[model samples]
Structure formats: C-alpha cells, structure tokens
Target chain A: MDRGGRMTAVVPTRATAPASGVRAAARIVAAPDGRGGTALPVLDGAGPLALRRTRAVAPGTAQVTVVGAMSAPLGGDHLSLDTRVRTGARLAVGSAAATVSLPGRCGRSATYDVRLTVDSDAELCWLPEPLIAAAGSDLAMTTRVDLAEGARLVLREELVLGRAGERPGRLVSRLTVRLDGRALLDQGLALGPGAPGWSGPAVLDRYRAVGQLLVVEPRFRDRPCQVAVLPSDPAEGEAMLTPLAGPAALVTALAEDALMVRRLLDAGRQAAAAAAG
Target chain B: MTITTTAPANRAALLVLADGRFPAGGHAHSGGAEAAVAAGRLYDATSLEAFCRGRLDTAGLVAAALAAAAAAGVDPLLLDEAADARTPSPALRATARKLGRQMMRAARACWPSPVLDALAAARPRGAHQPVVLGVTASAAGLGPLDAAHAAAYEAVSGPATAAVRLLSLDPFDATAVLARLAPDLDRVAQQAVDSARLALDSDVDALPAASAPLLEIAAERHAAWPVRLFAS
Candidate 1:
C-alpha cells in the first residue's frame, strides 16, 4: 500500500466472525510500475474468498476476478472487499458467479461491504454479478467509492429479489459515492418482504429485478445527455437515462426477471463506456 | 455560536409553511402521483392512501430528516449534497432545486434574514427543497421539530392534493386521508428530529437514507411526459 510513492505496509484487516459462521476479506491495489506496466503489489484474501489478476487487457490496466466457494452456502457470511487504483492506473474487477444468499443456521444476516478508491487520472470498472436473495434469507450490502479529480469510473449493480416462484427475502443496498471530497450520490433501498409496496406502480410496478449503471468522467459534464423514456420493451423492460450535475450519468432500469435486467445493464454499460471514452 | 434562539417565536409559522397554497410553485407538481394515476395504480381513495403512506415512510422520512438537520444549524451546502445523495433520479433532483429556488423567492419576501440572503447568494440557481425549507423555518424562528413536521406534512399533502386533480377524487376524501395519517406524520417527524440530533455529533451520513425506487423511476418517466398536468 504505497501512498505518494512511499512504501506503506499492507495490513490484513479481517472481520471477526462468530465461531459457527464464516467471514471473508479481500484487498487489491493496482498502480503504475513506471515501466509502462501495471503493478499489483497488494493482493490478499482470507476465508471463503479468493483473488486472481489476469493479463492486462490494455496498457496500465489489470483485470481481476473475485471467486467464492460454489457449494458453500453464503449464510451468515460477511464479505469485505477493498480496491484501490493508484494514479495513472486502470483496474477492472468482476465476480465469477452470482451470489445466492441463504439463511444461516444462526439466523444472522449475510453482509457485503465494498470500499473502492480511484486516484487522479485513474479508472475503475466494477461489474459484479447479480445478488439473488433466496427465500427466508437476509442480506445487507453497502458500497462506498471515493474518486479523485480527473478520475473516471463505471460501476454497475444488479439485484434480483428471489428465485422463480419463490417469495423473496430481505435485501437492503446502500451506496455512497464521493468525488473530490464532495458527495455526489447517496442512495439506499430495502427490497423484498416487509418493504413498502415495492411492486406498486409508483415504485417498481411489479418488476422483479432492477439494475443501475453509474458513469463518471470529466468530459460527461459538458455533454448534453438526453433524458428520454423509452417504450416498455417486453424483453428490455423500462429504462430511463439522465445526466447529473457534474461528470456523472445514471441509468436505472426494471424488468420481469434477472436476465432481462442483465440485458438492459449490458446495453447501458456499453453506452456509458462509449460516453466516458 | 448561537445564531438563533432554540425557542420558537412564531408557532403559527408551521401552519403557514405547511399550507399547500403558499405560492411556492408546489401546485404544479403532483409528487409522482400523476405518473401513478396515468399508470392506473391510484384510482380511488384507498389506493391513494396506500401510496401516500408508502411515500411518507420512505422519501418523506428522508426529507424530514434533512429539514431537521438544516433547522438544527447544519451547513446548507452540506445538506444540499446530502439531498443530492439521497435523491437517485436526476429529474427529481432538478425538480427539488427548482422548487427550492421558488421557495427562496417567497421566503425572502415573507421573512427577511441575513442567513437566507447568504444562502440565496451562495446558491443562485437553487439548493434542495428540504434545505431551503429548513433554512426558511429557522429564519421564521421555528425549531427543528417544526421544520420536520412541515417537511413530513408536505411529503403526503402534495401527493394527496395532486391525486384530487389527477384521479378526480373527492376533496373531502383527500383531506380525510391527510387527517388519518396525522399520527404517522407525527411519528415520522419525531424520528426525523432524533436522526438530526444524532447527525449533529456525527457525519451527515447519519441522516436517514430511505428511498422509494418506484417513485424515483416514475419521476424520470413523468419528466419526459409530453402531455402531463403535473411537472413531476
């Protein structure tokens, strides 16, 4: 963990789980090695988490994958992920599979906390799999991102309330995004059972899945991005796109199921990437 | 650093601010009720009540907390950022600032204050509606609880009023809907005040972050409506 070219020790900050449960933590830090290559001097994980860095897809860019046990139930599990992209570096992180959360034996809620930071002139694309909250399960997740001036980011989050024909469990998602010490976005939602009329027309209107794509770049603020409503395409669902005050744009879509949401999100990602470029 | 007194001088200011006909430009917006009505989701008194109740607990609670924090003397710029963070829809965010600018004009004419003037100067385009509301409440010598109550009441009252026009619901029923939710409004206002008090010692993130995704989505759709009675 080098701060301003100074070597700082990378400390393993692990969450203390109960004796009957499991806790996982992963940290990835990427920076420029000064030889036209990306350096990942800090990559570590603990518990039911694993991390791997692939070959650079582009100059000074690194691709990483976060893998968890396929058979192990994600009940009562606490997963913490920390990512940092230093100056002049780019990192793209994604998960290997969708997380199907289940009710823990101890009845404790599963949690995921992600903290991401991008330095000046850096970029990060976070494309995680959809989180499917199973019946009778409880899950809470939060994502906090800090970006420096001139940094760029494209982050996507997809959520599915439940499996087919099953009553969805509880899922609460919270996000806080800041640029240059100023908060740009702060949003929280509680979905599934006990949530207030989530399927109401003024809300989700019976949509079972939702996706959000956020793109932030210095150039986007100057462009006159149109905020239009597309016809409700049966396969694509409903989509709305809008540009924010600064270098940020947001796209929110709702669909009949996870596959449709993913389709919409994929299209949104392509559009946002092109706009950011 | 006591800029204003904790004790309110004008208890009736709450009533004045909470009035729907204060000429703050609130009449043009249905608070997403137009979208719901067009979608055939709110056609009767019962469904309108359900919609109002849902909004009061989520977006209403968040707005009340922001208002309470502003009345508690938090920085208006910070609260404006907090409001932006809480609002996910760009259309809604623009609507808030528009309403805020309109409210500032009225507040300046109604209650002249150096603080309000400073805020107006700082945010010439506008701040957020809840931020302006809290600041106006403070300028009017109202307390944090008063600001919270006003915010909470507006959350449901605007939609209820809009429903009357959109669905052609009876005025009596709309007013009755507000009356029935009075107890819930009080509870939400109290919770807002408590959250604001906590925010005083901690980060602004301590404020409530409750949100209604459908309302946010509907607002975006409503903003693009070619023929709509309400603005959002």
Candidate 2:
C-alpha cells in the first residue's frame, strides 16, 4: 500500500516538474553471494546521477558511491534514488563529494526522493555527503527507509546552509523511517527561505551545519541505549543520542562548520556501535 | 426566571483548561529553559524572549497542529502516532505522555465524555500531551481554534515561568516577555489550525515538521544532569 501510494504521489510531481532541468531516476540492489560475499545485481543510473562501485570495506560487504555526473539537481529538477539490500546481504552507499544546489532557469523548487529497503538480516549503511543549498536555490528532499524484522541500518544526513559566505537558499527536508511497518522516526525540518528563526538560539543558534545519525540493530529492542551526550569540542558544537521507541537511536548535532558537524556525528556513530556491541 | 442556555461554544471552559493550575503536571517541566539557562544562552528577559520565539516557531507550531487535528474529531490513535513521528527526542516523548496522563485525569474529572473515556481506554498509559489537550477541548465543548491557542500558549508559557525560577529574575519581566510574544503565538496558532484542516483531507504529514534541534539536544543532555529542578 505504501509503495503504491508513494509511486502515485511521485508521478504527479514528475509530470509537472519544470522541463528545463534534468530529471533522473536511479537504483541499486545488492544480494548475498553463495560464498558469503555481497554482489550488486543491479546498478543503474540515469541523467546526472551516476553510480560507481568501490572496494568493499569487508569481505562480505558491497560498497557503491554516487558520483555527480554534472551540476544537476537544480531548480525544477526531479530526482529519485531507490536502493534495496536483499536478505543476508550487506551494502554501504556513499557519495564522492558534497552536492551543491544552484538556481536554475525553471524558477521552480527541485525535488529529490530517496527510497531504501533493508530486508530481514540485511545491513545497510547510508552515509551520503552534505547537500549544500546555495543562495537563490530552492530544494525539497525526502528520505524514506523501510526495514524488515531484524534489519540493521546506519543512516546519516547532513545539510550545509550555504557556501563559504552568503545567506542560504530555501531547503525543506523530511526523514521518515519505519520498522516492521511501524514508525521509528519521522522528522521534518525547514531551513533557509520561508523558515523564520532558523538561526535562532533555540533552533540552529548561529550554527550553519546541522545533521542527524540514525542507527538500528535487533539487540536494541532488548537493551535500549541510554540518552547521553557525546563528547565534542564545546567551541565546535554539541551532540546527543536519544533512543527511539523501536530498536534504534537517533543522534542529532549542530556545528559551526561541516567538518565539525561530521566530527560530532562520527562520535555518535561510534557511541551507538559501542553501545550495541 | 433566570435563563440558562447552551451557548454556541463553551468559551470559558477554554480558560479553565489553559489555566496554569490545571493539574496537568506541566509545571514540572521547564520546556528546555532550564537547559538553556545552564548553557548561559538565556539570562535576562531579552534572551528569554528570543529562545521562546524560536521554540514557538518550531516545537510550539507542531504541537498546536496536533492539538487542532485531534479537536477536529480525527482519530486520536492516528494523531498519537503522528505525534510520535514529530517528536524525535525520547526524553520529550516520555515527558509528553506523562503530562498527557496527568491531563487525562483532570479532564475526566472536569468533563465526562464517552470519547474521552474511549481514548483513555485505548491509551491506558497516555497519549501525547497535545493530542490529549485537543480531545479535552472537544469534551469541554470547545473548537479547534481554542485547542490550538491553548497549546501554543503552553509551549512558551512553561519556559517563561521556569526562567523566572531558574534565573531569579523579576516575575514581571517574564510576564512581559509572554505579552510581547502574544502576536507570535497568534501567528503560530493560525498556522497550526490551517495545517490541521489540511490534514483532515490529506495525511498527517501535511502538518508542519518544524523542529528545534538545539532544544532537543539540550533536553537530552539535561535529563542526565545530577540534579535539576525541571523533569524534562
């Protein structure tokens, strides 16, 4: 039901999307090999969203990285990425560099939809690079992850308000994940345009870099992690880990720079790993 | 003979629910002000106003929308799930449900309704505070607008009062800060009502997802403090 509904919703948006910018659809599917290694049966990319296989971190894992083929995902563009890790397989997906959004001639906001499925006993690590919303750019991004029972995942998303020295463009992002058809987390954040007080003391607080890390494991249901602060430079930013209602925990951080933001999130990832271990 | 007629709306009932002494257990939580105070981000009324404004636009707006949706006679169960999705911080979620249970007890005492009873039976522990607030408004013969206003008011009022205690500042200054935020509160309530109405036709995702990441992070850290005045 959800899959059908999502596809229907994407159709209308894609149909009316500005014709002046690139519209891309991509997919990656990984399955387990009989020899206990992971194999990518399907790796397809279209338009500006290109995919390349990288060396595996472990013998049983397959790694893929997204390489931007062009300066795409501009205003009025519609982009979609679908990835599935089959049962018993492990896959890690990342990007080569930060995605920079620029204003296009279409004058409409760009849209990016990421859909991921992790089957039972499968593991997926989604660590994409930061998406920079430069001035005059308007983009809306949605990330949805569906996990079967016993699935494991580590997902991270980071946003950079603007480039080196300028006010940011409008960026609206939503992250929703479900485990066994139940909601684990659904958070929406709006920054840049149309979001008042985005940089206020209570929200971003003069910080430009913000991101969240979500980690999940089957054992968390029996032994949930504690809510605590992850150590980081006070001058850089702060980080915290809060267990979700399910077998997962979320780490949220805000920092003065993208590098610092990554550091805070990295600390969270390690803490989550150590706690789960 | 003196006449007693059922008015168009129980407008005065809204005041009772919105009262600070409503026995909802909200007074125990500082709404992140205690954390902000510890971090030295809020000192005088000036910084307090800024923090309240930011929170109102984000968390406050989201809560108002949830309350309005519940008051509009939507399924409380669905709205409860929606609330869970919007609240990413476990500390905040637990705090909301704890307060909801407290409010539920008071609502049952004040206004007896089968709907309230049904919701209580469904959520034996509790629902989200805003969802319960909306149902309580409905049981009291109020409308979605009233519920939205009440929630939006609570979002900042709790923190403002907490600051007075945490900072030992003048009570008058805190009240003044709320008075200045009256306009922002109105805007947030209106926005929430609009989103609630939209959610009636669409899914709950139509509601705003605005969040204060700093507020959430601070609340999580505050829960670990050795000794704190506020529960959240």
Candidate 2 CAPRI assessment class: medium
DockQ of 2: 0.61
User: Candidate 2, residues B1-232: lDDT per residue as tens digits?
Assistant: 1111123358889899999999889999999999998988889998888899889988899899889888887788888888887787888888999999999999999999999999999998999999999999889988887888999999999999999999998999999999999998988888888888888887777778788898988888888789999998
Q: For model 2, what is the alpha-carbon lDDT of residue B197?
A: 82
lDDT of 1 by residue, B81-180 (tens): 8898788788899999999999999999988999889989999999999999999998988988899999999999999999888878899999999999
Model 2 agreement with the true structure over A147-174: per-residue lDDT tens digits: 9999999999988887767688889899
Instruction: Write the residue-wise lDDT of candidate 1 on A1-277 in tens digits.
Output: 1111211222112234353667678899999888876788898966666888866566667888777543223557788889999998889987767666667667778788999999999999898777777788788889999999899998988877776677787888888888998887777777887776466555566777887888888888677355645346734477666676667877777887777777666666566656666
Leading candidate by TM-score: 1
CAPRI grade of model 1: medium
Question: How does model 2 fare in lDDT?
Answer: 0.85
| Shift in Å, residue A268, candidate 1 | 2.4
Q: C-alpha displacement of A212 in model 2, angstroms?
A: 0.9
